[model samples]
Target: MNQRLNRTAVVKRAAELADEIGFEQLTFTRLGRALGIAPPGVYRHVSDLDDLRRAISHNSARNVAVVLSSACAGLSGHQALSALAQALRDWAAMHPAQYAALQIAPDPNDTEGQEAAHELISVFASTLRSYQLEGNDLIDAIRLIRSTLHGFITLELSEGFKLERPIDLTFERIIIALDAMLRGWAV
Candidate 1:
């Protein structure tokens, strides 16, 4: 039993530690020490750092999907999109490390990885469906929304938005523009 350790426990602790420090700064040695185990002992729970990252990303995506879906509950169209966007932004602000971990692209061959990706996509699809977007239009809508929001988030987190404009206002304006695009995107 490794004295009370399990894959879930290891991953949970590792993710918390990653948030405490930074994602890239996380290491098996540090995770093991945090979990009160030896470096090699971590191998029992995770294959390697990438494996651990993939696990974290999977869990993070699932968590965000739940959050976004809950935010959109009983809402539709722009209301749902706004809630989803704000929830994502707030979640990222709170869990910067886990949010960053969620950015790791899933390996196509990995079922677990792909499932996690689908978990997030399904949330987007549900919201987009309210707009009656189908086929490539729906896919492209999701992509445009993701690309714009992800870009803004990545820049904000990295302090790349050094400017005179307030980010909060900027994000609000971005959402308005995005919603406008979504409303007219089908045409």
Candidate 2:
């Protein structure tokens, strides 16, 4: 019970630290200091840094799932995809550190973490299913949409599109491309 509670507290603090400092800088020692606990104390809760990272990944996945699911409600196909895309970008913008934490791949053995990731992906995949997509075609569309969104958002967050054109225009263009892709999706 004590370890579980400590793990919970540490995960919560790590999340806040990620929000404040950034996921890239989040470390066990930093997390310990943030919680006013010794570094070793954290080990009683988390096995090591990787464990802490997993916790953060799991936490952010759940958070993103909530955001995506809420945006996907009452929408379908391209409409749903647009809502999901905007929500993802907004969430990443609002929670850069947590968002970065979520970018890490969850361990295949960690079913809970994988499930959390799946929840978010399913929100996107389910939208495609509305168009009666199946097998490789459906998977391909999901990959296309996800990769497109992820690449664009990741670049935007890194300020890659710092040219004269407004980023919003570029984002709008992406939406158009996604819509066109959906229109041409194999049945």
Candidate 3:
């Protein structure tokens, strides 16, 4: 807290605060208070709240890419898919606020944000490569995987599931079904 707060440090702290509180509650005033600085002092690092949100979003995307890449290392196909899916679910569960940040689409004009977003997509696309998918097929497969995983994780995070059956069993069954679908993917 003694060192001069740089943009990177501010963004990192903002992400941590977002995880502690919720992203919606994150603001320059809150961040400044956390950093023991005035709101104007925070402006030296981030221009405003939207900028901070973008920074958080970019960081979230990069973090997810790193996690997914690590999870799928030395693995491929169904093995990779299972690891990647579980890693994503674990990440979402652990960092609900940052995970929410990841759900926001980056502004098209923001190069860094776009690149970070693409990095996440590339991780999923690479995992699906073993299925021999390419072009639109590859894109669709990526969407399917993301949508399925995101849907379940978001629902679980919101406590939307009211079933008596165990969620873990349901998640495992989902992975199995996805594996089968990937194996049988045509076109």
All models, RMSD in angstroms? 1.5, 2.3, 1.2
Q: Please provide, for model 3 over 1-187, each residue's C-alpha lDDT reduced to its tens digit, 9 standing for 90 to 100.
A: 7276899999999999988989899988888888898878998888889899989999999999999999999899889999999999999989999999998898899999999999999999888888989899888889899999999999999999999999999999998899899889896
Per residue, candidate 1 scores C-alpha lDDT tens digits across 22-139 of 9999999899899888889999989999999999999999989999999999898888888888899889878889999988999899899899999999999998777889989999
Between 1 and 2, whose lDDT is larger? 1
- Which has the greatest TM-score? 3
The TM-scores of all predictions, comma-separated, are: 0.94, 0.91, 0.96
**Over 4 Å off, model 3:** none
Q: What is the C-alpha lDDT of each candidate?
A: 0.90, 0.83, 0.91
User: Which is better, 1 or 2, measured by TM-score?
Assistant: 1
Task: Give per-residue CA lDDT, model 2, range 20-96, as digits (tens).
Answer: 88787888789778777777788888898888888888888998888888998989877887888899999988888
Off by over 4 Å in 1: none
Q: How many residue pairs clash in each candidate?
A: 0, 0, 0
Per-residue lDDT value at 149 in model 3: 95
lDDT of candidate 2?
0.83
Model 1: residue 18 alpha-carbon error in angstroms: 1.2
